[model samples]
Target chain A: MITRTLFAGFGGQGVLLMGYVLSHGAMHKGLNVTYFPAYGAEMRGGTANCTVTLSEEKIASPVASNPDILVAMNFPSLLKFEPTVVKQGLVVLNSSLIEESPSRTDIDLLQVPTVELAREVGSERAGNMGHGGSSQGQGKVLRTQP
Target chain B: MPSEKMLMRGSNVVGEAAVRAGCRYYFGYPITPQNELPEYLSARMLDVGGTFIQGESEVASINMVLGASAAGGRVMTSSSSPGISLKQEGISYMAGMELPAVIINMMRGGPGLGNISASAADYYQATRGGGHGDYRTPVLAPAGCQELAELTFVAFDMADKYRSPVMLLGDGLMGQVMEPVIFPDFIDLKDLPKKDWILNGCEGREPRAIFSMLLGQGELYHHNLDLQKKYDQITAEEQRWETKNTDDADIIVVAYGTAARIAESAMNDLRAEGLAIGLFRPITLWPFPSTAFRELAQNGRKVAVFELCLGQMVEDVVLSVGERAEIYFYGVPGGVIPTPAEVADFLRSVAKGDGEVGRRIDV
Candidate 1:
């Protein structure tokens, strides 16, 4: 089975780093993988995103139009990519930053108040990590939120 | 010998591969999407006892490569779209002189300051002898990080074998993607064929001149005829391509570089659905693997040429297949890359065209 994920957020939100880490782990695991990041001015305080695809077979085309998982770190990213997720796929969002609920009804929505949770844990900038960890754990996004 | 696996970007791996291929000199200017190539070689070439120079411009850089090649030094240069345009004059001169050099074009969106995004728009420029005059250069397109490294070694060899420039054609995506690659043992330059024609201070013999300009009557014409003969030989011997389940298929899709990778996935998807689809990826863009296309056409196969540009390689496919096979084309120009699912769906829609005539040709 192939797993495609789209990680989107503002430029400074560690969006591309998350993709790199995921692809690095996939490569070490001997899985065929591809990580494509948006380049140029978009990486400087603008909307940025990356596509990461891991599969047992050789991956074709690094651009995923409908990813199985969507990691939206900001409201813009969520609004921009919400409609493109696969049916019954997972949408992991930082609830603290985005107040508008996703309009899609077919997919599973996981809301983590990552900023609020990061602040409570005293790091304040760990929202990206928090959301990433939540995206990996499919069923615990809501169950583990204390 | 076991090689050490290292994780690196495609651009850096290509640079390292050039060094391992016995490339002792590099000249290039900085350009986005491919800046890492020159940057990596700039610091590492000296470590390998090679020379690296960041030229003021692409023209100057390609000329430096020409000079290095004329001296019989294994040399390379790299640039992006606009930079490659600037190097065309130098490339024509190098071809005229019959010098050996490796040029890497990590193409970005083009047609004048286009954008810093991945694109295969330079297909025509790379394969059709972008430089002026009548000359042809062998070109290779690598699909992944490992292929990028592997083709760098092959590019150097092909250049030296033919006494002409060879191009390693890729896009920004191939340059930026990071993956694990294992480096093999460096080729021993001493063991390879020596450059007997190098003008290394011709002593104890008659004086030899290396000239790109021949103004005498029939001088350039005869030189061009010899070059044409050499090109014909290369076309016969150096055509490289890959086929997946093409032995028995109704629809054969022809693509190259990243587009080929995507087309492969699409073919797999369609195959699972009982569609008779196969993929043909050209590793050597020039020489074009036309023989493979001719064989497929002789076996009565239909073709669909998919590209990231506006149908460049499709022309070659049509010429090779001729009226014996029907041809179709789908292309997304500039930096927009079509998804595998999208391509698969498109292939599915046309999978049942058993008796349809050629869409691209009037016959």
Candidate 2:
């Protein structure tokens, strides 16, 4: 099975780094992996994201249109990418910033207080770590903790 | 076994490789997905008795590179999509003067004012002369960090050998990701060919005049023809590509750089599913591996071209096939990267005669 994940947020929010870490972990596990980053002006602000694909076989297009997993670090990111997640896939949101819940019910949703978790970790940058483990209550949404 | 393989990001690898390649001058403005390149070079160049200039803008940086190259020093410049657009004029000038220089374009999305997303949209601009010109710049598209170093070294050699500008065409992922890279030992600059055409003080031998202008039509035509001849030579001899699972395969996937690496993953997946799919990745974008593709297509084998853009490289794939076999296109646009399973599904559909032509998804 191929698992495609998209991590998106602001420029300095470590969204891209989260994708990199997942790609590294996938590679370490001997799975085929590809990490593609966004380039150009969108990097300045608005939104930034990277696609990470891990699979049992060689990957074809590194661009993910409907990601199996979507991890949005901010409100705008969640709003922008919430529509792109595959049906019955998984969505992990930072509850501190994203006050509204996803409208979709077909997919699994995990709302974590990532900002609070980061504060506990002594850095807001650690919010991405909130996506590190299996989802709470919802078995579909896996949130891997640091 | 040697256990010292450092897990370094792609940008640092490119920077280190440039320094090892004897690139004494670097000028660049920062951009996303590739800032690590300039940052790493900033310190490394100082240690190697070289100079790195974080120019105020991409335009200024490329012009600085052109100036340094004209002075007979090994110089380089790097930027992403939008920044690359600004350096086209300088690239054209570099080509016109037959200056040997290396430029890196870590590609991103684009049409006009695009974002920082990985896209093969720059294929036309990079391969077909972005700057106003009747000249061509040899472009090397590296898929990973290893190629980041290997191609960087080769780019400098090719630039000096052809007396033309060379580009290391990569994407954001290849520029920012961390991976193991074996750095080559430094080479003695004196051992390399002396730049007789450079405009540095011509103290002894008859003063050499370096100019892109020609006084007469005959002279201009001759110069253009000369450049064409050199390009033709490169096309014939300097082409490079990698083929996987092509032996007795019914389908071949053609891609380059990061796309090619992704294709590799897809090919393996499809192969395990009892499907005969192979991968053909071009390391050199310009002087593209048309010959190999043509040879593969001649046997009535099905070929599929995969790219991050809206079917730019597919044109070349079709041209290479020459209607000998079916050539399909899988285009992933707007910063969307297709997964291996997605590719496998597409290949399966094609093998089963259920494939659709020009199918695109906006993920």
Candidate 3:
């Protein structure tokens, strides 16, 4: 089975790190994995994203066109990538930052109050980590916390 | 064992491989998608007691490499598309001087400052020699992180063995992707072979001079011929490729580097559907790997060339397949990455249009 999750948010939100942590954990488990990022040319404070693919078989392409899961940590990311999620795929949103609800009815939705959760933990900067923890529940992509 | 296995970023994997392979001198200017390479080496080189310099520009970086390599140092430089273009002159000079240096090009979409996305558009530039004069750069195209690490060692060795510049042609995806790579153990620097032609210090022996300019009459011609002889030797011995299920196949898909990875995904999907599609991937792009390709194209099999650009490597495919087989071309140029489903759909359309009035074969 192959699970591809795309994580997207503003540049400082640790979006790329979220994907890296998951892909790194998957690699330690001896599962085939690839973490591809949109590495450059992003305007300062612009959306930064990465795709993490984990599978039991050797991954073929690192480019993710359609992902099995979309973790949108900001409103712009949700607006941009919500359409690319496969039918019946999961969409995890940082509900604290995104006031709008997802329009798609065909797929499951997990609204993670990441900023609120991070605030409870004493630092809102850890919102991405909270989001990552929540998204992990959808696919169980890694056995332990990443 | 567990501690030895680190999940590394693709760009860092190459850096780690180079450090292990005894590449002690690294000079490069940072470029996007490939920035991680220089970033990793900047610190890692110091750990290995090597020199890492962020040159003023790509031109400066390549020239720095030329100086180091001529002095018998295992040197490397890396850049993305436009930055690589800036280094072309130095690359040509190094090739002409018959110097050994490793160049890593994480190709991005380009004719100019193309978008920072993976591309194979530099095939001609890398294979036919991106710089001036009559020469060819030994090009290795690795498909994944594992191959990226392994081929990095091969690239350094190939450069030293042939005393010529070698290019590792990876794309932005190849550079930016993070994956599991089991790297080989480090090479002992003391165990490496000594280069008799090095321009190092001369205590008693006559000082050797290295220059590409043979201004004397017929001097340049003879030098070209000698370089051609060396190229011929490399061509004869270094053709490398990976063929999958091509024996009974009808249309063989020819791809390398990043395109080959997507093609594999498409090939797998089609094979599961009981199709006769096969994959032919060239691990070494400059040597072209034509011997097996020509043999596989025996007696009129169809060949489909897939590339990340507007058909750069497809021309090489045309040269290899010749008149023996009909060839088709599919490409997504300028940062438009095609998915496996899209590629499989294209293949299905090709397989279904076997002998229609307007067939799938473009050549």
Candidate 4:
């Protein structure tokens, strides 16, 4: 029962923190987890992305071939990773920034207005965290966390 | 040193493990993926009352390691592929001078500044003694964070025990991955064994001069002979490997570091379908774990060596297995990470009643 996820956005969007939150939360709950920060592959304006894999058993590969979930905090991130999400997988996109819908219809899509939500909450930079919670509900992965 | 279970980044785990292992001096230059190691040490070293220096360059950093180790300090330095390439001369010097220091190479892309992705392309450079010398650096290739933590301690111990340079080898994936790990109790520095060969604290005895230069006739040859004897002893006793179900298996997969992780995943996927396959992982890349590896090939099992480089370690695998079994090779070069599905595809092909496995197949 391995749940592999990729969280992506520009450098300062706290995208990596989103992955860390999920990874740490899963690990704290006694699940095996591996969070891989990929610093080189960002083609759109040199952003950093990370891949997080959490499993009930030991995880073999930290580099996910096809992610079960992709939390895209920006337009380019969505554009870049939307094609790589596995079929019938989940994609939590920030509707605040990614205006276009996903091209593939096989996977599940959940859109949240994270930018406006972060602005409303008075912390404009916390937009990534707003949508990051959407994927935490996946596989009941973070249900036990406070 | 807390004994509680903790989730930490792979790089940070190494830093804390080094500190817990009684390492008091660290010198390293920043490189992509491995930067977190020095970053963690920068703050943690201060807390541990240790010394951390962001060396001006990779060469400068390894030389600093050489100096500190000569002074009998538990010291370490880390770098990525290109950075490690630059440190070879100093590493060679350390080897010839018989200094104990731990060096971590969080391997990234290739020949030149390829990319910041995981790769085991430095296998030949590491296992064959990257620097020019009649010396072999003990190499520990950790597959995950837990092993990463444990092996850091082993690397330090091996370095000091052998009075030679030691390398902790892993790819960028090992560096960036954050995983849960419970480490052992911290090693009290005072309990560590004393070294009389160091260049410092010789007030009551003759002032010690430590160097690799043996200009006298037969001096370098005798030094090389003694170093060879030490390496031979290491080869006999320090070959470390792990085998999964090789006792009753027809096919064995050989790999190390990050590549072994992928190979295990692929092997497991095949095992679910009930394939008679096993995995042979070498923890000690140098010393190469040849004896244990040779034992696994006794029953005419088909051996496959998988690596992230273009068939470097496969040569060592061939030498280990020899004509005892049918040996095959699978390689992924240039920092491209191979998925388990792809690796499984290859393994599946080999396992499906094939009359003979191909020799040196590079994919």
| Top TM-score model | 3
Model 2 bad stretches (over 4 Å): A1-146, B1-4, B31-33, B355-363
Docking class of 3: medium
Model 2, span B1-363: residue lDDT tens: 222345467788888888878898999999876888999988998898899999999989998988898899899999888898999999998888898889898887787767665778899889998999698989999887767888999999999999888999998767765554567777677777787688778688777876788878599889889989999999999999988889888988888987887777677767887888888888888888889778877576787788888888877776666678777778788766666656666777667766654442221
> Global lDDT of each model?
0.85, 0.79, 0.88, 0.87
Q: Write the per-residue lDDT of candidate 3 for residues B1-363, one digit (tens) a residue.
A: 212667787889999999989999999998888989999999998899999999999999999999999999999999988998998999999989999999999999888988888888888889988889999999999998999999999999999999999999998889988888888989999977788999778988998899988999999999999999999999999999999889889879899988888988888879999998889999999999998899998666678788888777877887887778877777888977788877777677678765431234455
| Residue A117 miss distance in model 3 (angstroms) | 1.9
Per-candidate TM-score, first chain only?
A: 0.88, 0.85, 0.93, 0.90
Provide DockQ values for all models, in the order shown: 0.54, 0.24, 0.69, 0.62
Candidate 2: fraction of native contacts reproduced:
0.31
lDDT of 4 by residue, B1-363 (tens): 556888888888899999999998999999987988999999998999999999999999999999999988999999999999999999999999999999999999888998888988898899888889788889999999999999999999999999989999988999988889998789989988799888776689988888899999999999999999999999999999998878778899998988888888888878999988899999998989888888888777888888888788888887877788877777788888888877777787677636233344332
The fnat of each candidate, in order, is 0.56, 0.31, 0.76, 0.71
Error of 3 at B75 (Å): 0.8
Q: Taking the tens digit of each residue's C-alpha lDDT, what string does model 4 give over A36-103?
A: 88876554566878998988998887877789998888889889999888999999988887899999
Task: Name the candidate, 1 or 2, with the larger TM-score value.
Answer: 1
After superposition, the stretches of candidate 3 with alpha carbons farther than 4 Å from their true spots are A144-146, B1-3, B354-362
Cα distance off (Å), candidate 3, residue A44:
3.9
Model 1 clash pairs are none
Which structure is stronger by TM-score: 3 or 4? 3
Write the number of the candidate with greater DockQ, choosing between 1 and 2.
Answer: 1
Off by over 4 Å in 4: A41-45, A144-146, B353-363
Q: Give candidate 1 regions above 4 Å deviation.
A: A117-122, A139-146, B203-206, B298-300, B352-363
